[model samples]
Target chain A: MSSTTTTRPNGLALFILPSALMFALFFFLPIGLMALMSVLTGNPVVMPKVAFTTRHYARMVGDPYYLEVIWTTIRIGLVTTLVALAIGYPLAHWMARIKSRAGHALLLMAVLAPMLTGIVVRTFAWMTLLSDKGVVNQTLMSLGLISQPLKLMYTETGIVVGLVHIYVPFMVLTLTGVIGRIDERLEQAAENLGASPLRAFLEVTLPLSLPGILAGSLLVFALAISAYVTPILLGGFQIMTLPILIYQQISANFNVGFAAALGIVLLVISLMLVIAYNRALGLVSGQRELQ
Target chain B: MSASIEIAGVSKVYDGGVRAVDAVAMDIRQGEFFSLLGPSGCGKTTTLRMIAGFETPSSGAIRVDGADITHVPAHKRDMGMVFQNYALFPHRTVAENVAFGLRMRGLDKATITAKVKAALAMVELSGLEDRRPAQLSGGQQQRVALARAIVIAPRVLLCDEPLGALDKKLRQQMQFELKQLQKKLGLTLVFVTHDQEEALAMSDRIAVMNGGRVEQVGTPTEIYNQPTTRFVADFIGDTNIFRGERTTTSTVASALDVGKGLILALPPTEGQGTGVLSVALRPEKIRLITRTDAATAAGSSAHGIVENTNFLGGAVLYRVTLESAHRVLVQQPNAGTSRLFVPGDGVTLEWTPADLVVLKD
Candidate 1:
C-alpha cells in the first residue's frame, strides 16, 4: 500500500504531462510573447530591437480615442449583462417549473438552438433583421407606427441586441442549475404563510438564487466585452469597442505593440471588476448569516 | 382564534389515473390535536395538503368555520403549514422567518416585533433569533418552524411529519413538547405521521388510513382496544391473529374451532353466523401458566411448549408452539417474584373470552 501510494502521484504527473504541454505551448507562450512585444519598439520592415519602453502604455492611457473605446466597451458590457439577466431569469424559472420530461426537453432545445450555429452566421442574420426595409421595419411601417424606417443598423443599440441574443443562453444555463436546486416546498411554505405567489418568488426564490445571478452576470459581461465578430458586423465602423480597436491596430495599422498593450489593459479592468464583485458578494453573504 | 375544519367526501385523482386520496371524510373539532396516522403512500399527506388549500379535491368540499374554501388559493386560506423537512428559508434569519407571516398581514413594526418575541419565547428559542436555520440543530430548526407557523394565529396549523427528521430521543422529547404547546395555546392542529407511538402519545383522536382510505378514526384507547378491521388491528401494534371457523354461538359466549383440536372462546358478536371468523388478541393479554395451574382456569386454555424467549427490558416475549404445532406469541411482565419460562418448557396459554376481538377481514 505504501509503495502504491508513493507511485500514485508520479503516475498522475505522467498522465497530466500531455495536456500541460499543450496548454503551455498554445496559451501561455502567446501571452508571454505578447507581453514581451508590448515593451519593445520596432518596425515591421526592419529587424526588431529589444528595448524596454513604456511608450505604448503611455499612448494607450493619454489618448482620448482609446479612453472613449474603453468607456464604450464597459457600457456595452454592462448593458448586455443587464439585458441578458432580464430575459434569462424568467425563461430559466419557466424551465425549472416544468414537470413533464417532454416539456423540459423542448424548452432546453429552444434555449440551446442559438449556440449550434456559428457566431458569424448569427450576426449576419441579425444584420438582415435590423437593416432598412427588413422584416421589423416593414411590419412597423405597414402598421403606421413609424412614418419612416428606423435606423437600427450601425448603432450601439444594434450591437447590444446582437450580443444579448448570442450570450443569453449562458445566463439561462447557469441560473437553471441554481434555480433547479431550490426545493419546491420552500415556495409552498412561503405561500402558506400568507405570502402571495409573486411575493413568495420575490422574497424567497430571488434571494436564494443570488449566487447564480452573480455568476451569470460575470460570464455575460466578460463575454460581451471581449466579443469581436457580432460587434463589428452589427455596428460597422460607427461604434468602436475595445476589441474592435485592438483589431484595427493589428490589421490596419500593423501596430502589434500598441495592440498588445490594449489587450493587457482590458484584461486588468475585467479582473478588477471581478474582484470587486466577489468582495461585494462576500459582504452580502456575511450580513445574511448574521441576520 | 382557532376554527374547526370539515373535510366532506374529499377525493384526489392524479393526472395519470392514480387515486392518491379516496373519499375520505372527517371533521376536526376546534382546538383539537388531531393526527392522520398511516404508513407511507397512505394519502395522509394528500389529505392534509387539501385541507391546507395546497391541493384542490376532485369531488368534495372543505369547509373552515362554515365557509367553503375548496377552491381558495393557498395564500388566502389563512392557514400555516410546517413541512416534513422543516422548509425554513435558509437565507432568512430565525427572527425574520418568524416575522414573515405577520409582516405579510400588514402588521406594524412594534406589533410585529412584540409578536415575534412572544412566539420565539414560546418555543424556548428566545436568544437564537438572529441565527440562520443552518446554524441551528435539527431540534432547534423544528422549534423555529413551529414558531413561524403559530405566530400568525392561523385558523388551522398543518404539520406534515414535522418531527420525522430528528433522532429517536429528540423526537420523543419534541412530541411531548408539541403536545404541551398545543394545549397551552389552544390551537387547532392537524399533524401527519407514520410512527404509531407518536400518534398515540400526542393526538386526541387519530384517523388511521390505508390505501387512500381511512380504516378507522377513534381515540387512542378505542383504536387499540376495539379495532373493527383486521388492518387496524395489525397496523397499530403487535398481535396474534387466529383464523378459524365459528362452531357454536350462544347469548353469553361463542366458540371458534381453530385447527388441530384447539378451540378459542369469543364474545357474542352481531352478524357473525357459524362461518369463517378471525380473532385478534394482543400478546400481553395471554398468560403463560404451568400445566397444573391451567386445569383450574375457567377460561379456555391451550397446551404448548415454549419455542423461544426474548427478554425485553420490562417484559419477556415468549414464542410457543402448541401440541398441534400452531405457533403463538405470549408476553408477560418480568417481575422478580414470577418464575421465568425457558425454551422447551411445557406451559398453557390462558385468556378469557372477553379479550378476544372479532375483526372483519
Candidate 2:
C-alpha cells in the first residue's frame, strides 16, 4: 500500500492494485520503453555510439507506403468490427431471452467454443475451410456456382474473415451481458401498451441495447486493429498492415527504431478509439439518469 | 368503453404436468374493479395473465364483450398491464413513456401530446417529463407505469401487484390513488395481489384462491363474514376452526361435538340441523372475562388460562388454553382503561352461539 491506500479510506486503491500493476507491466512500461527506443539512434545490434534522432517518425509521416499500410489496417479493422457486430447482436438478443438455464448455457457454450481454441489453431481451422481446394471451394464448384475457386487467402478479405472469426465470441459475450441486464418486462410493457411485437422490440429492446452495441463494436475494433498472427498468417505477403509492416521492419530490415515508431502509432490509434468509446458511453448513460 | 370479460373453465398446464391454474372461471362485469387475491403459487397471477393474453389457456374460452379472445396474441388484446416491477422503458423519458401507447394507435402528434399531458396530470406526475425511469423514485416509477398504461384508454387495466415494491406507507397511499383512478376512469380492472388486506381494502369484489383454485368470490364483507370454505375463512383473517360431527344437546340446543370434552354450541341460523360439521370462529368475536364469577355466566363459554399475549397496539390477542387442552384465541381492544391480563391470568372465553360460521367441511 502507498499513501493513496490510506487516502482512499475505502481501500479501493488496494483492491485495484493487482490489475493496475498488471496493466503497468504489460502495457505502460512496454509503451514507455518503445517510446524511448523510437527516438534512439541505434538498432538493436551493437553500435559505436548512441544518439537521439527523429528519422523513423519522419519517415512514417512522409512515406506513401506507410500511409497506405495505416489505411489498410484501419479498413480491415472497420470491416471486421462491422461483420462481427452484425453476427453478434441478434445472436446475443436471442441468447439473452432464453428462459431456461440449460438452454442459455448450451447456446453460450456454442458461442465460446471458438474462443476455447488457441488463436493460431482457430486461424488454421478457418484456413482449412477457406482455401481453394478446401470444403468451401469444393462445395461451390460441385454446386456449379463458379468455374474456379475464388482467391480467399493471402488477401485483406481473408485477414478480415479470420479476425472476425477470432473476435466474434468476444463481441457476443459483451453484448449478452448488457442485454441480460436489461429487464425483459420492458418489452412486455410495450406490447401491453399496444405496440406490435416488431415495434415493441425496435422501440424498447433495441434502444436499451445500444450501449452494449457500442461497447461490443469498440471492443472488436480494438481487437481487430491490434491483431498480429491472424493477419500475418491469412494475409501473408499480399497485405501489409501496421503490425505486419512493423514485424518486417524489426526482423528482416533490423530497424528497431522504426518498429518502435510503428508501435507508438498503433498505440495512439487504440487510445483514440478508447477515448471515443468513453465519450459515447457517457452520452448514453447520462441520458438515462439525472446528474 | 369498458368490456366485460368471461373466463369459463380456463386452465393452464405447464410442462412436466404442473397445473398452475386449474379450471379457473370468472365473469368480470364491465367497469368493475375485481381483484384476484391469494398466496404465492395459488393461480391468481396465472389467471390474470391468461386473461391478458400473455398466456394461452390449455382448455378454456375467454371472451371480452362476448367475443372470444382466447387464442389472440398479447399485443392484439388491447389491454393495458402495469407490471410488478413498474417496467418503464429505461431509455425513454417520462413523457415518451406516456406517449408510446398513443403513437402506437396512430394518433396525431397533437392528440398524442394532449392525451399524454392529461395522463401525466391524472397521475400527478406532470413536469417530471424529461427524466428517465432510473432518475425517479419507486413511487414515481409506479405512477409513470400507471400513466403509461391508462393513457391508451384500454378496455381493461391489469395490474400485477404494481405497488408491491413500494414501502408500506407509500403502498397504502398508492392503493387509495389507484382505486380513485379506477373509479374515475371506470376501468374494468383486474388486479392481482397476495396481500389479503390490500385486496380487501381496494376491491369491490375479490376472488380468494388457494391451491390453484378459487375458493370463494364475493364482496369483501360477504367473503369475510360468510366464507363458504374453511380455506377462505382461515386465509382471509385470524380465526379458530373446529372439525367434528354435529349433534343436538336438546330440542332447542344444537351443538357440534368436536371430540374430547369440548362441545361448542351452534347458532340456529340458516344452516341448522343440516349436518354441517366444521365451524369457524373469529378471534375478535370471543369475549374474555375474569373467571372469579364462580361459573355463574352461562351462554357458550369455556374456562381457560392465558397461554400467551400478542400486543397489536390497537388490540391485545390472548391465546387461552381451556380445561380440555383446546386453545381458544380471544382478542380484546386495547382501550387504555380496560383491564389488562398477563400470561398467567385465568379467564373465561365467551361468545354468542351465532358468532360461529358453519363451514362446509
Off by over 4 Å in 1: A1-23, A43-46, A287-291, B249-253, B258-261, B270-272, B291-299
Clashes of each: 0, 0
Task: Please state how well chain A of candidate 2 matches the true chain A, as a TM-score.
Answer: 0.91
The C-alpha local distance difference test score for the whole of candidate 2 amounts to: 0.88
As for candidate 2, its interface RMSD to one decimal place is: 1.9
Two-chain DockQ for each candidate model:
0.53, 0.60
lDDT by residue for model 1 over B41-92, one digit each (tens)?
9999999999987889999999998899999999999998899998999888
Model 1: per-residue lDDT, tens digit, A1-291? Answer: 787667544656788889999999998998887887788785434755556789999997889988999999999999999999999999999998888889999999999999999999999999889999788898899999998999998999999999999999999999999899888889999999999999999999998888789989999999999999989999998999989999999999998899988888888888987998798678656555443
lDDT by residue for model 2 over B269-336, one digit each (tens)?
73446464888899999988887667623337888999999999999999999877888788899999
What TM-score does model 1 score on chain A?
A: 0.90
Which portions of model 2 miss their true places by more than 4 Å?
A1-22, A289-291, B250-253, B270-276, B292-299, B334-336
Task: Give candidate 1's error at residue B44 in angstroms.
Answer: 0.9
Provide the overall lDDT of each model, using Cα atoms, as 2-decimal numbers: 0.90, 0.88
DockQ of 1: 0.53
Per-residue alpha-carbon lDDT of candidate 2 for residues A145-169, written as tens digits (9 for 90 to 100): 9989989988889999999888988
